[model samples]
Target: MPAIPPRFSVTPEEIDRVVATFYASVREHPGLGPVFAAHVKDWPAHEVKIAAFWRNAILYERGYDGNPMAVHQEAGNVRPGMFDPWLGLFDSVLRHELAPETAAQWSALAHRIGRGLRYGLVEAATLPGGIPKLV
Candidate 1:
């Protein structure tokens, strides 16, 4: 079995802080808010998921085990354009809250994760033979 990397050094507060900052950026982003709003209604609960996601990503914490793309893709939510900026904003938030090395390490994994999410989004957004019809 692969050895776990050193336990992430950030506290929960720092994790929450990163999430808060990223959402603050997203709410202001004209491209992001509508795409997010069209799919997600409750913001507060979503924020909590955001924190859980980051903690799992950065720390190998087990709370977030869902296939990132599968959930988003299967839901048929998420605009294609929004994914890139969402990732950019997340990296910016992490950099603002974390040490340089921490930011770099986390950012790399975030990119890989985001790419998976992007594939899911693309799959959802571009269903063939007209928009997907509910069964």
Candidate 2:
């Protein structure tokens, strides 16, 4: 059987670049910086892990082995409102680091995943009566 090719035009090196650049911007972002800083003590390791995740997502590799939704839910500080700013920053990084068509493709995939993650967070935080949890 033949191996499946990467889904898009991005390379592993490009994924690394995008992950590094995006996280750098995230570390400086007023809305996101503190949240990440609270959890990620080693930026290099986090970037490598995230790069592997992107590789797994876009390239169909098996390098990443974590559940983003579960991690975010367990974090207790990852709010649904944070997805907008996070996606915005990620889109900007994709646009700046990749070709126009590639960026669009990746952004579409990212937005879909972000929406799912945000929905999961919201659903997990809601009460049985459809009301949001105050805590």
Candidate 3:
């Protein structure tokens, strides 16, 4: 099992800050910017959704409801190779904005999510008839 943070706690404010900075970085990213810009029409609304996603993920707040896999698959713009830079940016933001331990904890979660998303994308791409539709 992974070691839990004994002295650190994730808060809503921290989640919000991290999400804001991380997405801002993504918005400026050369490869990712156009991809995100093509999809999200409302930046503020997207920010709230992702911030809630991180809060619910790290804090178990159960505030997020959207299906990430479906969303990514539907994005069509997110290729399999893009996860690395996305995770890198996320880790960089966490490391810069939070305590080391807290950042690691958050980064670990991001890594897990990134891996899953990438795996799903890869599998979908390899399917015989293209990605299957989610019910």
Error of 1 at 15 (Å): 1.0
TM-score per prediction, in order, is 0.75, 0.97, 0.87
For candidate 3, write residues 38-87 as lDDT tens digits: 99999889999998887677666667899999999999878879999888
Query: Which residue segments of model 2 deviate by more than 4 Å?
Result: none
Q: Judging by TM-score against the true structure, name the best candidate.
A: 2
Q: Which residue pairs in candidate 3 have backbone atoms (N, alpha carbon, C) closer than 3 angstroms, thus clashing?
A: none
Which residue pairs collide, candidate 2? Answer: none
Per-residue lDDT of model 2, residues 1-135, tens digit only: 876888788999999999999999999999999999999999999999999999999998899989999999999899999999999999999989899999999999999999999999999999998899998
Q: Which stretches of candidate 3 lie over 4 Å from their true place?
A: 1-8, 128-135
Which structure is stronger by TM-score: 1 or 3? 3
- Candidate 1, residues 8-112, lDDT tens digits: the string is 577777888877888778888888777677766877888888788777776777777556676676655465566678888888888888998877777787788
Model 3 scores what on Cα lDDT? Answer: 0.85
Query: What lDDT score belongs to each candidate, Candidate 1 first?
Result: 0.74, 0.94, 0.85
